[model samples]
Target chain A: MANPVWMVLRGVCRGLHLTGYFCAFGTALFGALFGQPPGLRRMGWGGFGVALLAGAAWFWLQTADFASASSPSAVLAALPLVAGYTRFGWLTLARMGVLLLAMLCAQKRCWKLAAVLSGIGVLGQAWLGHGAAMGGGKGWLLFGCSLAHIGAAAAWLGTLPALALGLRLSQNPRALAENYSRLGLVCVGAILATAFLQYLFLIGRVSAFFTTAYGAAALAKLLMFSVLLALAAHNRNRLTPALPASRAALGRAVAWEIGLGMAVLLAAGVLMQFAPPAMAMASMGS
Target chain B: MRRSLFAGAAMVMLAIAPAAFAHAYLTTSKPSAGTTVRLDTSSIRLSFTEAVQPEFCAVTVVDGMGTHAETGKPEAVPGHDDELTVPVHFQMAGKYIVTWHALSVDTHKTHGTYSFIVGN
Candidate 1:
C-alpha cells in the first residue's frame, strides 16, 4: 500500500508502544513473582514511561492520518476531533489512564499491581489492530486469541532480562534455570497456540501466506521464531545445565533471543500496517 | 559504534515515520468537496483510494437547517469498487454536509465530512 508518511510514523509509534508495554509487563510480572532485580525494576519503570509517550505521539499521528493532513498544525487541529469522537481515540484515552496508574504502581513498588495495569494496557491493544476489524463472534474470538498471544509473549520474551538477572544473582543458578525453564516452556506453548489461532482468523486461506504483504511479514516472523526456538533449546538442554560455568554463553544466547524477539515484533508491527491476504485476495477479485 | 548505530536507527525511524499508512482515503466526491451545486442533485457519490465494505459503510447528508437529505443506504457502485453512492433528497437551497464512514476491505476505518452549498 502506498501510504502517506503519517502511517509510517504511526507504525513506528505502535512498535515503540508495544515494545514498551511488553517490557513493562514482563519485568513487573516476573519481579513480583520472583526476586525483584534492581535492573529489571528500573527497566520496567522506563518502559512504562516510553509506552505513555509513544502512545500520545501515535494518537496525534493517527489524527493526522484520519484528517488526511500533513503539517504539525493540521495534526494538532485534527487531534481533538479524532480523540473526542472515534472509538480508537477513546481506547487511547483509556490506555493512557491505565499507563498512568501503572506508573504510580511502579513508583510505589507494587509490582503485582503494576503488572496487572500493564496487562490491561496490552489486552486493550487488540482493538487497535486487525482484530478490531473482526465482527460478530469471530471478532470476539480473535480478540481473545490476540490477548492470549500478547500475554504469553510478554511472559516469555519480557521476562528474559529478569531471568538473566536471576542467573547473575542466584548461587544455585542451575536450580533457578530449571524452574524458569519449566515456566518458559509453558509460555512458549501458549504463544505458539495463540499465534496459530490469530493467523487462522486473519489469513483465512493458505495461499494468502505466499501472496500478501501481511502473509510475507508473518512468514518472516515465523522464521525468526524458528531460530529463536533453536537457540532456546540449545540454552535449555546444553548451556543451562552447565550453570555458572556457562553463564556468559547462556547470557549471550538470551541476549540474542531478545534481539530476535524484537525483530519478530517489528515484523508484527509491519503486518498490522498492511492488509491481510484475505482482504488482498478479495480486493483482487473485486 | 553500537551507540551511534542505535542513534542512527532512531533517526531513521523518526525520519520515515510520517511517510506511509495503509488506510483508505476519500479520493473524490460528487459535487466535489467544497463547491456550489444546483438543487436538482438527486444523489451523492464518493470515491475512496481503496475498496470498502458496502455493508459496513455509511453516509449521511444533512442541510444547515438540520434536515436530512439522505434517502437510503449507501451502496458500492457496480464495477467501481472504490465508489459509494448514496441517494439524497436534496431540494432546498442551503449548505449541505456529507459525512461518510467507511470500512475498507483491508479493515481500516476512515471517516470525514465535507460541506457544499446547494444553491448558487
Candidate 2:
C-alpha cells in the first residue's frame, strides 16, 4: 500500500510531537499541583489524562498491522498507527518509560513505596527494550539523556500551565514567584547539563560542523538553544529582579520560556529518531 | 520531602551520566536476512534514519569460503541519509554474508549480519 502522504508529512514534521508537547505540558501542570488545591489542577489533570488515553486509543484504532488492537493501553498500539514506523517503537517507549521510572524512584529520599514500584517498572522496560540495535551500557546513556531531556522539559514548560492555574486561583504572589525562581533555575541547569552531554557526542571535528549532516542538525539545535539562553538571560539578569510590575507578567515570561523549551523538545523528538554520528562507523576498507 | 527531591536529583545524575550520549541503530535489512544473493547483486545497502559515525560503519561482503572481503569500505553518497550502499564486484558468486557494525549519531554502536547466496 502507498504510504499516506499526510502521515509522511506529519512524521517528518513531528505533528504527533505537537500533541506530545501539549500532553507533556498537561502532565507537568497537573503533577505540580497534584496535591495542592482545587480547580483545573483537579479538572485539567483528569481531562488531560482522558485526552491522553483517548489519543492513545484513537491512534491504535487506526492501526491495521498490529495483529489486532489488543489493548488500548499498550504503548505499541501506535505502531500500526504512526506513519513509517520504527521497528522498536514499543520497545523504545518501554525503555524510556522504564528507565525514567527507575531514575525517579531510586532517589535515596523518595517514598520507599514509589521507588520500589518504579524500580519494578524499570525492569519491565528492560525486558521489553532489549534489542540488538538498542540496549546495554549505551542504552543507559540513551535512557538517562532522554529522561533528563523530558524531565527538564516538563519542569520548564509545564510551569507555564501551572503558573496560569496559580494566577486563576489567586495564590500568594510572593510564594509563586519564589517557587518559580528556585525551580526554574534548577530546570535550566538540568536542560544545560543534558545539552552539554548531547554536544559531547555530536562535536566530532570543527570542520565537520559545516560539512556533516550530523553537524548541521547540531548547529540548528545550538541556534535554538542560544535564543533560549538570551531570553533566559533577560528574565534572570533584568526582568526577574524587577519584581515584574505584576505577578502575571512573571507568569507570562515563564510561559514564553516554556514555549521555547517545547520547541527544543520538538527538535529533540525528531533528532532522537536519528542515529548518532559518532556511530556512523565509516565503512573504512570493508 | 526536600531531601527525597535532592536524592532523586542525585540518582538521576548518576543514571543519566552514561546514557545522554547514546547514538543510533541499523534497524532493518533487505535480501531477506539469512537468504543469499548472487555476486551480481547491483547494490548492497545499509540504511539508518539518523546520521551515522561514518568513521565506524562497515558494509563488507565477506566470502564465506575464503574468509576474504570483497570490497573496500562503502561510502554514504551525498543527499541520501536513510540508506548507505556499497557496490559489490563479486569475484565469483559464492556463499557470502554481509557483516556490519556501526555507531549511531548518539554514539551507540549496533552490529548485525545478513547472508546472501551468489550462484548460477
TM-score of chain B of 1: 0.80
What candidate 1 gets wrong by more than 4 Å, as runs, is A1-6, A280-286, B1-87, B91-107, B110-120
Model 1 C-alpha lDDT per residue in residues A115-223, reported as the tens digit of each score: 8887788778776654444443555566677778877887888777778777777778788888888878998999887876666556655577788767887898899
Error in Å for residue A226 of model 1:
1.4
Clashing pairs in 1: A4-B19, A4-B20, A5-B18, A5-B19, A5-B20, A6-B18, A7-B20, A8-B20, A9-B17
Say which docking band candidate 2 falls in: incorrect
lDDT of 1 by residue, B1-120 (tens): 999997787566444322112345676788786689888888888877556667557888999889999999998799886789998877689888888888664446667888888984
Instruction: Quote the lDDT for A123 in model 1.
Output: 78
How close is each model in CA RMSD to the real structure? Answer: 11.6, 11.9
Query: Which candidate number would show the highest lDDT if scored against the true structure?
Result: 1
TM match of model 1 to true structure: 0.72
Please report the interface RMSD of model 2 to 1 decimal.
10.9
